[model samples]
Target: MSYFGGQPTNPFGAPTPKPPILKRQVPPLPENLDMATLADIRCSVNIFSPATGEIIEVVVGVEKRKFHVHDQILRSGSAFFKTALSKEWKEGKTRVVLLPDDAASLVDRYVQWLYTGKVGVTLDNGKTDYATLAGLYCLGEKLMHDAFQDRIVDALVSGTREPNNNAGHPTTCSFPMKDVVDDIYKGTPKGSPARRFMVDMHVMQGTSGWIDVERPESVNHEFAVDLAFAMMQERAVTGETKTKHAELNRGIPCSYHKHGKDGVCGGKA
Candidate 1:
């Protein structure tokens, strides 16, 4: 048979239609191409200039683990470091800063975030590592980095609201456990954004089973009081026990953010 399965012809003796054109596969560029020659290539912020500044040795945790970070980047990103690295401080003279109380792993994460605006944490069973994030928040608080703390809050909110890989893709928004709560409450002071966010989470999505009444230690005293007061205020205003979990979980992104008088919400101008 012909290529068209037979000699195909038009009834009016018109020209037969041409076959569809096949697209040619273009080969990828070679691995050793000169990247500098590419036009309009945006460059990242020059956070690392080894030749320009001195290196600060940060000794963290009881183990005395050391991280040699660029002084300029560290000072530029952290208020604590900026103050500590100043000429008036002993750390500045010694060129070494010590954080004996903070967790080394968390310090490592902070360092990673300092270098690249992102850091990764190990998840448990495909679930977000709330405890690790909580630790990072506490570390950020200690470091006096509002931007870092705000980022942690954002991570917490996004992680909780993410859909699980279950049959229904249900949202497994588990409130921070007792240890996490204790760590946060102990690390952060009253009215801290982390504390407020925890209180709000419990008020919206908490259940009786979330707290073990028999084990009083499982609940932080301040957290329990805050939860009760929040629940009462909600009931008084709305006149119902219905929880606004959905709204709290997915509402305004800046609801739990910490902003100054003129500072913008969600860290944007």
Candidate 2:
């Protein structure tokens, strides 16, 4: 009996092999993991203009308006502040920054954008105050925040179109000021979104000529060249073969298109 009942007599005993056991692989944790420990930290900041000659003055513009702002909010919104307020910088130590180039009005708007994510845009008579937009855009560019730049562009584009009239007629588009156009071109680098936006705005309005004549004295030669180049490129890609045409067969009428009986479209075929 070879260790079993009725088993064959073993000429030679052989050992049975067992299946190999597998172990799960566990990843090692990093020695120094970054955490969001500072999310709840709050701080205050002072903004000053260089003219005031004091970091704590928080002066802005020629009028010398001052602003006491929250540091965490400003730092979160601006790449400029994030770097400027870093531990190694004097800005961080003093919690103060001098914005010599910024106007008081514009600085106020920037602070508002940080806190509320809104910029005051006034649109009137198919014309937008590009001056404000340009100033804000420049600040965003200087701070290296693309999102801020985009917000300004969005506001500009949205504000350019007029509200529908009572008769439902589509209104004329806004005309950008020469000062606004010039400021953007002067401050932004070549191929900047704001630069291209101004070019497109002019082109779409069929007023590329405005670029040449509007505030000629303030225009930089390089800016003019760039504008011309942008216009040419835009035209080349957009294609200018089609002429403006009107539709006569559509069933819908609207005041915006000067179609419907009451100056409103019924959305019919």
Which candidate leads the pack in TM-score?
1
Model 2 lDDT per residue over 1-269, tens place: 00000111111222212223334422221122112211211211211110111223245666666676655445544667668877798887887777776787777666555443444465353345567788888977787666667777777776566543533555645556577777887778888877777767666675645655656766667666766786777764222332211232233224246564554454643
User: Candidate 1: worst 10 consecutive residues by lDDT?
Assistant: 1-10
Report model 2's TM-score to 2 decimal places: 0.58
Best model number under lDDT: 1
Candidate 1 Cα deviation (angstroms), residue 188: 0.3
lDDT of 1 by residue, 149-257 (tens): 7778877787667666653547555456777788899999989989988888878877888888998876789999998898888765342422544345556455456
